[model samples]
Target: MRLMLLIRLIFLLLLNGVVLSYAHAASLAYEFSRVSNNSTEDLGRQLSMLVTEQSGGALFTFSNRLGVPSSITDIYFDDASQPLFSSIAYHSDSGAGVSFDSQAAPANLPGGNVIGFLAGFSGDSSAQSVEGGVATKGVMKNGVNSTDEWVSFLGLWANAGSFDGLIKAFADAHFRVGLHVQAIGLAGRSDSYVNQPSPVPLPAAAWLFASALFGFIVIANRRKV
Candidate 1:
């Protein structure tokens, strides 16, 4: 009887470990943001609308200034949304235009998901000279200025067997992904934002299977005793 109890304990430990491993294996996380106001609501609504339309899921705001240290606020999405890997755009203090860091996606993320990003431009008419683009080092166009920007967009690209394989693809190539919105400036301001990785809930079927497995293990132990 004692031996049977020990066996059951070991089985339970192993099962818990498997669930934890799967949780770590099936998800990815990243940071994203853009410039916007704190006093207004239009920009917030616009940004939320754009991200939802582009990503085909819900857009949860995070922060206004993730890349920019002096930024007022930056935004992030909920875990349910796939995230794109990249670096923050650097718009200089002197306004020599925007400079993007040499950014690359990590070689391995937990989930086998792909993502794309797009930004709409709107803001102070004077600061309108602020522009952005993807390049080796910096923003290419000066006329690309806008208050609102699409810092990152997420979408499923392709599936892989392992997390490491998915990461490798993100690191190596730029896959053409689609955006949900075409506009640049959101109407209002958002100060607070959400940035935590989304949790993957176990499906009901999986839960039932696990329960059955546990019951079988229990019965097996009883017979052995």
Candidate 2:
């Protein structure tokens, strides 16, 4: 009985640790999709992404897909999201991203084919990065009845504070940006993109794995009894 009790305690602790890890994860984890299909650029393999915080700003990364090698990236955005909230932050893993060129404006802006920046992210810990950024607010067309915004950062100058400072820097730049150009892609593909929520399943897998383990342990415990 005591052994079972101790096992339960450890199991609970392990589950709690996993939950806490995600709760305070410094990485800006999210699922995103195109806000609209009205893109002028052709979309390729959806670039898997990660965003996180640095000393005064945030960082990002692009990959071929989850669990696969990191891929090069070039498109980003300063979405018109209000408050620039980030419960998490992350950087890229293998290859960092950069701007191929700078000529297009964001979607909500006066001139541009899309609503994204020409910037990309590096590995979460890379020293290579772009500086300065832009943020849009409730300007992206999210279909017939919705609107949205985005935040793109190279190296935002913060007020010398912590994570909150990062958020503030973006909030401070809630204006239309000029000359970001469009993200590079195929000759006939659209480079500009908008954002909508994505329904990824990776994050939930942790709990599923834990439950499986718990079931296995219970079975073994009953067998021993």
Candidate 3:
């Protein structure tokens, strides 16, 4: 009976540890999609996307379907008017065909493009990555060109002090962004509906509680034995 009690106690401790680990670690995560399917003309030949609240952690990977030389110029978290982050050259990933001359074929941005400058949480610049998916055609009538680009940034973590208030502000809030032509003019405008931050599962804690109760029962039984 004593051995059983000890075994039960150990199991409960281990289970609680797992819950704590998950709660502590931040996984940079986010899901995104185009804002609308309106024709390119109706949308003004611009690129825009909505970043939903299905995002967590500090590392953010932002991708845009804008044409070449068109890049993410600003990021607005929640309702603030001024951009939370901005940069002219966010730097493209290898999949963006960094070497390819856009003027030659007027190719679209690579779907696997990644912007590295947005990473703020993880000090490791290399943590940003690009997943090169198939290049989808852009909102052009020609339908011959592909306009997509991506970049990863160590978001929030690195700039927490400057963005401390915004960590939770984005949850249930909208993220509006602007894409600009490298030369001049606005390329596109897009926004996403960010859901409220989902709470961590309580099942882990519930299991821990039950385990503790079981341990108590085991101890009580051993005393009687």
Better of 2 and 3 by TM-score: 2
How much lDDT does each candidate structure score?
0.30, 0.36, 0.34
Whole-model alpha-carbon lDDT for candidate 3: 0.34
Residue-level lDDT of model 2, residues 1-225, one tens digit each, is 778877976787687778655543445444334333334432333443344555555554333332212222223344333323332223212222322222222323222334443222211112233424432122111101111112233444323435454334433543112211122333222222232333234554577567766876797687678
lDDT (10s digit) by residue, model 3, range 1-225: 768867877886777677655543332233333333322222223333222222322334444344433333232232233334432122233253221111112121211123211211111112122326534322221111124544443333223323333444444333322222222224442222222332233344567667777877877777887
Question: lDDT tens string, model 1, 1-225?
Answer: 768767877787677667655544443333322222243332222222111212222222212222211222222222222333222222222234422221222211212232222221111112124334432222222211233332332333233212443333333422111111112235322233221122223354366557757876887777777
Ranking by TM-score: 2, 3, 1
lDDT measured at residue 199 in model 3 versus the true structure, 0 to 100 = 27
Q: TM-scores of all models?
A: 0.27, 0.42, 0.32
RMSD of every prediction: 16.2, 11.5, 12.6
How many angstroms is residue 171 displaced in model 3 relative to the true structure, after the best TM-score fit?
A: 1.6
Best candidate per lDDT, number? 2
